[model samples]
Target: MNLKIDIDKVQYDASKRSLAKVQLNSLWGKLALNRENYDEYAIVESNEELWGYLYDKSFEVKDLFCGTKKALVRYKTVKEYNSKISRGVNVVIAA
Candidate 1:
């Protein structure tokens, strides 16, 4: 599967803690599935180390900060994680 990371066009105002609207795509959906299947796939922590495994298709990790397990799978970055959470999507870090 192909994965792409796209940032929302609208910048989040750190001071205000407001976020811009975002649209989720198919690739993102696939990522979500991957995240949800962490239990079956054996997800892990350690972002730096996980990259190699993710690239090799051996393992995966979702950094959702305070998100639910489902949201973390689709989101690949901290920003994406936060954006999904802001939109009411539940994202959580999982291994």
Candidate 2:
């Protein structure tokens, strides 16, 4: 991602902070550019779909652990949690 940023040399607002834009492609550029695209892998697609559900369904799924523990928590496979999801219930696995 060539995040080419255009920063204002001087403060652009009363907050005395430079203005930045994330420059998303549009129209023809959007069609031509592959800047934003999703992978077609099975697991990746499943994870993406799950995230979409969590966000769209308004489920607040967040955790605070460090290192390996965090990774484990982030993608932990909880049998009970899976059952809860199957029954259409919101879940937040406390770490």
Task: Compare the candidates by lDDT and give the number of the best one.
Answer: 1
On TM-score, the candidate that comes out on top is 1
What is the TM-score of each predicted model, taking all chains together?
Answer: 0.18, 0.16
lDDT of candidate 1 at residue 18, scale 0 to 100: 30
- Measured on C-alpha atoms, candidate 1 has an lDDT of 0.39
The residue-by-residue lDDT of candidate 2 on 1-95, one tens digit each, is 67666675644573333222223223334335432132222122344555553454333334423343222112322233334223222123211
Q: On residues 1-95, what C-alpha lDDT tens digit does candidate 1 reach at each position? A: 89675686666586554332222444345334444323433344556434554464433444433223322232232233333323322334211
What TM-score does structure 2 among the candidates reach? 0.16
- Segments of candidate 2 deviating more than 4 angstroms: 1-45, 64-95
